[model samples]
Target: MNAFGMNAFGMTALPTRRQLLSFAAAALAAGVLPRRAGARPLDDVVAAGRLMVAVYRDNPPFSHRKGGALVGVDVDLARAIAGRLGVGVEFMELTAGEAVSDDLRNAVWRGPVVGGGVADVMMHVPYQKEFGLRNPEAVLFGPYQREGFALARNPMRMTQPMLASLPDEPVGVEIDSIPDFYLLGAFGGRLRERLVHYMTIPEAVEALVKGDVAAVVATQSQVEAALGDRAAGFPITPVTFPGMMASSWDIGMAVKENSRDLAYAVGDAVTALLEDGTLPEIFRKHGVTHNAIPVE
Candidate 1:
């Protein structure tokens, strides 16, 4: 018996399309709806609507272009995150070294970059003390995986004595990477004294295949992917670092300092997945063997 046939509860009006969509998304997350109603949290995300996932597309097996689609471990993870949020995924190709470059500094996702807002979150970021110190705003997610490098060699050439005597062999490594740091510093500059150095890990792999060098030290992921694919005939194997040379590292999604709310949410999401064994299951499907890195 009130105005517009509404009661005296001060009824405002019908729900907007955006509100309807938002409610639906929350319902979907809560499992109240089974159809995955829509891919939009509120509205179709036609405007102000995209979760940009920044990643390095070149270094394969992590983030890369495969089958004309943006794919890899990081890619799948990003899609899953967006799907949970009821949002569409947008691939933002990026790398770590160029983090402070003009492109990144001016990148824009939500608001204006002048305010130092985030354009996208970087995925598969290695936990580095220097990076954390420099970008106090940066936050890493759970240790999605524990990984290390090893010298893969042909089984025919493998021997316990040869493995033990590797310090004297010419080794290949990339410039300015963990391997380079380990070999140059941890190895007592032994690579220079014994193993030959390569401009890249692949170069070293080539050297190993061609017998140019005895072995090359590289990440397990890189070694596995390369050898599994085009390098199938190489007959490579792995040798984990001896003892606790370096504590295992946890790599995760990297969010800007300003977007702490988003960071915390994402971090929590990752941690929850780890706790429930979801993340590990995905890694298993990808054939990525790793240790679960707990998120504090």
Candidate 2:
């Protein structure tokens, strides 16, 4: 995992999650379709009467399966955007690839080798200038949320939000995550033995509840969603690591470069949703805190 990047896409495992942050150069798969011919324009999408939206499969609080139905913030947002556009919504669930660039190629600008065509828009893309510059084939826009790390601690065990308390109190983190690495090396490695690793943030939060760890460090949304009603006692607050590379980042949507019109239309729709309070409500419904993107 690149220390400079957070696992914004919410892949279940560390290896795949790490790959999403690299944003490195990548080649499209052999079966990927040509960009200009593959990406549908706004008029073409309207003519089809439905907007195809791509979301990462099994990404909770964002996109995931619940009661055998696909749902989450991204899913609801996609439906709302399509509704605003006067079209039906169709979802194309995506599996995380080796890098975010690969995902954009598969989800926004090109079709996967197995022949599923790209979606008109892909949700939960990292809205970073460097990333956008590296992948000119896709346009990144509509930053809906600012994602960052937070400490969710058991009040009885950890009275303070500061990392200073972690030396004696165990801290849980997703194995190989930025938080995990941060806890391992931060404070001159004094807290190494106190670090507990889990496969996911939910698991780490579970440990916090069970008294297995005094606190769990992870993305704010994951911490909030995992705690749910139990969040009443546990406090969620930000803590800075002395040498942390990226403590937070904005997340948005991506469209094919040729689909700038679609991007603009979707961005406008999101702004309307935010202004009308629908966007924050969507996040609340999923048990996640809605951290709005700062106005640029």
Choose the strongest candidate by lDDT.
Answer: 2
Runs with alpha carbons beyond 4 Å of true place in candidate 1: 1-49, 98-118, 128-133, 161-164, 167-169, 184-190, 193-203, 206-212, 229-247, 275-278, 284-287, 294-296
TM-score of 1: 0.63
Candidate 2, residues 123-188, lDDT tens digits: the string is: 999888877886789999999998878899888887778877764878898887778867887778
Q: lDDT per model, in order?
A: 0.54, 0.82
RMSD of each: 17.2, 4.0
* Candidate 2 clashes between residue pairs 3 or more apart in a chain or in different chains: none
Q: Where does the lowest 10-residue lDDT sum fall in candidate 2?
A: 3-12
Worst 10 residues of 1 by lDDT: 1-10
User: Can you give the lDDT of residue 86 in candidate 2?
Assistant: 95
C-alpha-based local distance difference test score of model 2: 0.82
